[model samples]
Target: MKRIAVVGGGISGVTAAWQLARERAAGRAVEWVLYEAGARLGGTVETERRSGFVMECGPDSWVTEKPWARELAAELGLEDEVVASNDAIRRTYLLWGGRLVALPGAMRMMVPVDLEAIADSPLFSEDARRAYMQEPERAAELKATALPEGRDESVASFVRRHFGDEVTRTVAAPLLAGVFGGDVETLSVRAVMEPFVRLEQQYGSLILALRERATKVKGPKKSVFTTLKSGLGTFVEAMQREIPPQMVRLREPVEAIARIGGRWQLKSSRGAEEFDAVFVATPAHVTRRLLEPLDAEAAELVKLEASSAVVAALAFDAERARGMEIPEGFGYLVPPQTAGEDSLLACTFVNQKFGHRAPEGGVLLRAFFGNRAAGTLMAASDEEVISRAREQMALALGELPQPTHALVRRWPFSLPQYAVGHLDRMRALEERVARLPGLRLLGNAYYGVGLPGLMHEARKAAEEALG
Candidate 1:
């Protein structure tokens, strides 16, 4: 039997192992093992509940548009447990001009799907709204324009060009920051927002393309996000259930995978072991260390990537929170210009988002801080992070009583920033690794950071490896 080793126990690593197991169960001649430096199986996907309040250490849910996550749930017998978001009260707020401005009812990642609604909405000035109305024609005119050769631009540049500076600063920046935890000015457009780029390239304008796509849809609208009733941790547990016992080694740190005797050898604290194949799903920074000994140049590219974040969850009595009169909304994102240097990135009304987040009469609030500026916030003491969160909440909502309890989860070097021309960089790294047979790269840093993207990439890597 061929023995394969999977490095990192996060969603991607676990999913890769699961796919390989499926191959083995089908009578394939292969055996696989998973290694994790940490004791936990979920990586950052942690959910803790106490006193009827649930706290998500990592992501709360996965978007249903990405089918890999949903399909995995059914494969694990968790489809029934997958609960959709409470659509009855769906709302999101954008913090602009020192106020929690409700986002237009129909908006997609700062794109105003409904121009008339946006024109009437207070999120943009009249002049800005007028500029937006003219974007389709302007973008059509600019369609003949081509991207500069061998280089990628930033999200800030794309948003400013298609929309305007006002939209970039006031709306897109904050919402994007919540996802990347890095500066949009440096993040890559091709890597981060490729779909938008494709829309522009294919139809000559994103606005027109969106309008055309909307007219062609034939089914009733479905919820975009879903999570297990017990929380996303349940999904992790479900996946873990499929993995064989003794195959997963918790707290076993893998130091490197180097070519030895035409086979890959894993060097770790537990000593060296050989495997027919290997998969890397850890953070890019850690991936760098492991790859350095094999290909110094390729490892350097991984070293260039970095990510970090902090999530603070505050629990409060529902009646007391209601007294503060915080408006009804899903959550709010703080624009960088308005948020200043020391503020948070975003806040989620966890209790309002999903009914099961809190007990029948309690409230749970989540404050997210990401990237370098927010990385400093992550490095701060837990009490200090919570204190900052409290101050931010006070500014957003009226003053309220102290939280009954709080939990702070730190994810160091967690979210990867796809820097300008990141796809090119990734391609170069893939070429280098391809020379090493049976070795594959799979992680959130490359294709996407969402749960579904990770699973999708994991499945692809496993299929390729097993074949």
Candidate 2:
């Protein structure tokens, strides 16, 4: 029999262990152990349920375009739980000048597929509108100036190259920050926004590419996001149930990892253990430390800056929620510069975004604190965090009623920032990792930060390690 070790019981690590479990049950002649430092699993993916309300503590849902998470849900016998977002009223608002303004319809991020929508929208100034209108004509120029085959640039530069400063600041920055929790000025265009980069290389103008894409891609439009009816926490629970309970070692942190005699050795609270293969799915910082003794150069390559986040989910009863006039759209994002000292990053109208989140007539609102704000607020009491979120949200959506149920969560250094040239660094890191036999690295620290990406990476790493 072969022994395998999986460190850090986040979604990625858990998924890897689950894959191994499946193989073991099918007579693969393998045994595995999952080590988690925390008391619970799921890392940032968690859900809270109370008073007929299902509030997501971390990620509410995965983007529908990525099938990995949805597929995994199906494999876990959660097929009926899969639900799509309510795209009929899928409008996202922006907090500008202390007022909520709806972004133009038929717009993908900063690029507007419907030029007429941009012209009629109040979100962008006349200068920004002109930039959108002129982008098609400048397609040839953009193509000529596109970065060479193997070069990378900041997301800010890529957005400015096409839509100029106003669009980058007013629209792009907030959208990116809401997802990646980092400054557009430092995030890599090639790594974080690869699809858009490819469009730039091919069509030069993102607007042109999106317009053509709209016409060519023929299908009943899918929802932008998808989730299980019970909540993402159910996904974690289902995965845990499938894997043998004895194989999971909760609260046992991996102190260090080393490559010895072409095998992997992991030292944890239970002392040292040897394995035929090891999968490290911890956060970037932790993984860097574990890799330091094995290969200092690889450690240097994995040293990427990460950002923190804070979430507050407030669930109001039917009567109290009805009294508050919430907007129809999904949620709103606060531009960093416009936010000033305020820590609010974004808020989600949970019921409107997806069904089954709140009971009939009830409401659930989730507030996200930005990276800088999260650092200062992480140490505060849950009441303080909830109060601050409620106060900030009330400013945009009028006086909010006292919530019937509320919860707060803090994730420090969770989102790793993929800086410019991140792809190049990851390429070198992959090469170094390959040199260490029976070792694999998996997590949000490389490739992507989305649920689907992590699932895909974890499954592939598990298969490779087994082979």
Candidate 3:
């Protein structure tokens, strides 16, 4: 049997192994082993249950438009376990000038395609509204001219150019920052949000793209974003159920990986293993260290840069939360420009967004901190982090009630920021990897940082390795 080893037991690693196993079960005659540095299989993707509260350490749900994650869930017989968000409450908040304001309903992320929505929304100032109105007229001239080649611009630059500084700094920047957990000024608009940028290039107007998209009817619009009824951990548990117990080795960290005599050798603190093929699914930095001896240039590219973040889950009585006057929306995101005043980047109203996340009379709030310039915040003590979160919560939610429960989760080098020239860099890296036989790299850094993106990359890597 052909032996294959999958390193890093994260979503990407597990998915890759599972796909390979599926192919093997179809008479490929392949043997597989998965190694995880941590004791648990899911990396960053974790759900904790405490006092009837289901706290998600990483992502709360997956986007349906991506398709890969949802498809995988269905294939695993977990369709019944999936639950969608309350569409009636599909609202997000933005922090502007020390106030939590609802993002305009029709405003999709960085694109303010809905003029009437922006005008009617309370989120922007009169000046901001006037400035945003000029975008369509300004963009018209660019549409008439020849498009630039390899247009590489930051989210801040692109937003400010089309929609004014207020829109960029207050709304666009915060939304992107919350999603990427990185600085908007360094984030590549084309790389991070290609669909929106492409829509603007192709249709000349974001409003037009949205209108066209609205007409397309596919599947139940009800479950756009979904999670397991039990918790996100249910998905992880389901994946584990499909794999043999002996194939997965937890708490086994690989220190080095090198090619020896036409095969791959992986050295871990626990021991060493040999395999015909290998899949690297850890973070870029970790991958860099593991592959340093084998490929110096590949390791260097992997060490470019990544952002760190911390999530604080605070639980309080529902009565106290109601007394604090917290609004009905899911949560609010703070732009990087409002750095000092609002140390928090975003806050998720856990209880309101998902059912059974908190006790019947309890409220759960998850606050995210640290971006590019503020990554040092992740190193702070739990008490200090909680205090900072409370300070921001008080300003956004109006009042701060002492929490009955608080959990601090820190991620060092959590989200990788795809800056200018990122695609070119990835292309070069892919070409280099193609030269190495029976080896593949898969993770959030390549395609996207979302769950669906990771699964897509994993499945693609598995196909390449098996082929």
Candidate 4:
């Protein structure tokens, strides 16, 4: 039998195993094993079930903009189990001056699409409003000049170049924290916000490009995010069910990987094993360590030091929540500059975003705090963590009572922040890895961090490794 070893139990590893499993199911004649260091599957994609509530300690959904995850779900017979966000009240707020202000309707992820929306927003000052409006002419004038191609810059510089410092501080910084848990000044423009940059380059103005996009849209659009009926854990469970039970070695952690005698060898707690091929889907730093002895050059680019993420979700009593002055939207984001040292990143109205996650009449909100600021809370006692969560929620959602239920999940070095030059590094790493035989590295540290991105990498790995 063709022996294959799958290292890491995260979504990427599981998806890659499942893809290879399909090939064996199609009469390829192969045996595969998945090694998970932890006792359970679904690394960070954990969902805790309680009395009538689904508490997600990690990601909640996949943005529908990327179709790979959904397509795979359909293939797994999970089409009927899919659920989208509650679009009717689907709105996001940004914390400004300690107030939860609705993100202007026309903006998408900090890129202002509507000058009128900026004009209507109380969050922006008069100078900001004027600078926001005049971006197109400035961009057009800049576009008239010759610029070098393929130059990379930070997300902060890109936003500030067109939108000004205020936009970067208030909109981009907060939104970047909410998503990547990284400072915008370090995150790469080419890796993260390439589409916006490309649009500007093509049309000479983002406003002009957005105007054309809006004009061409002839009908209503679908909600941008989707999840499963039983929470994200359900997706993990479904994948586990399809994988051969004996193939998954829970509590078996891989220690090192080596390429020896035209085969890949993995040293784990159980001992050493050889495989015709191996996929290391652990975190980038883990992957780096595993490959360092075998391929130092490749490891250099694959090494990504991830950031810390602390998620604490608290539920309010249904009756008590009814009369509270909680913001009536999807919650708000706190910019780093305003949040200061040891500040919370953002607060999410979990129940408001997806009504199914909570019990009837109850309110559930989650706070995402990251980096050194989040580290302080993560190292604290559960009581301290919950207390800080309460304080943050109160500051963002107005005065609120103690939680009827609270959960704190600390994930250290979980999110990989793609900084400037990340793309060039990854490209070089891919080229180097391609030269090696029967080895593949899969994880969010390279291209993307979302579910769609991970699934996309899995598909590519399957095609490249198996085919």
Which has the greatest lDDT? Answer: 2
Per residue, candidate 1 scores C-alpha lDDT tens digits across 308-423 of 78899998876656675667878888887777666778898888887788877788889888755466886688899888888887788757578877899999888888889888
TM-score of 3: 0.93
lDDT of 3 by residue, 1-467 (tens): 88988999988998888888788778787888898989998888888888788889888898766778778889999888777777668788877778877888765675655688888887778998887776566657645541355767887787776667887877877887787776778888778878877776776656566667767856656645777767877777888877887999899888888898999998888778899999999998888887688888877777657888788888886666566666786888876776674378889987778777887878999998766424666667889878878887888776688887788888888889998778778888888787778888878777678988888888887777667
* Regions of candidate 3 where Cα sits further than 4 Å from its true position: 122-127, 145-149, 215-224, 317-322, 372-377
Whose TM-score is higher: candidate 2's or candidate 3's?
Answer: 2
Which tens-of-lDDT digit does each residue in 129-163 have in candidate 2?
A: 89999999999999888878799999999999898
The TM-scores, one per candidate, come to 0.95, 0.99, 0.93, 0.96
Q: Which stretches of candidate 4 lie over 4 Å from their true place?
A: 145-147
**In candidate 4, what are the lDDT values of residues 1-467, reduced to their tens digit?**
77888899999988888887788788877788999999998889989877667889899999988898899889989998788887888778877787778888867777667778888899888888877888777866756641246678899887877778998888888888888898899999888887887776777667777878878988887787898866888878888888888999999999988888898888998899999888889988788888888889988887676889999988876876787776666778887888866667888788878757888888888888897777787789888988887877777666778778889999888999898889899889889988778788887888889998897787677756766
Clashes of 4: 0
Candidate numbers sorted by TM-score from highest down: 2, 4, 1, 3
Which of candidates 1 and 2 is the stronger one according to TM-score?
2
lDDT against true structure, model 4: 0.83
Name the candidate, 3 or 4, with the larger lDDT value: 4
- Model 4 RMSD, rounded to 1 decimal: 1.6
Pick by TM-score: which candidate is best? 2
Quantify all predictions' global Cα lDDT against the true fold.
0.82, 0.91, 0.79, 0.83
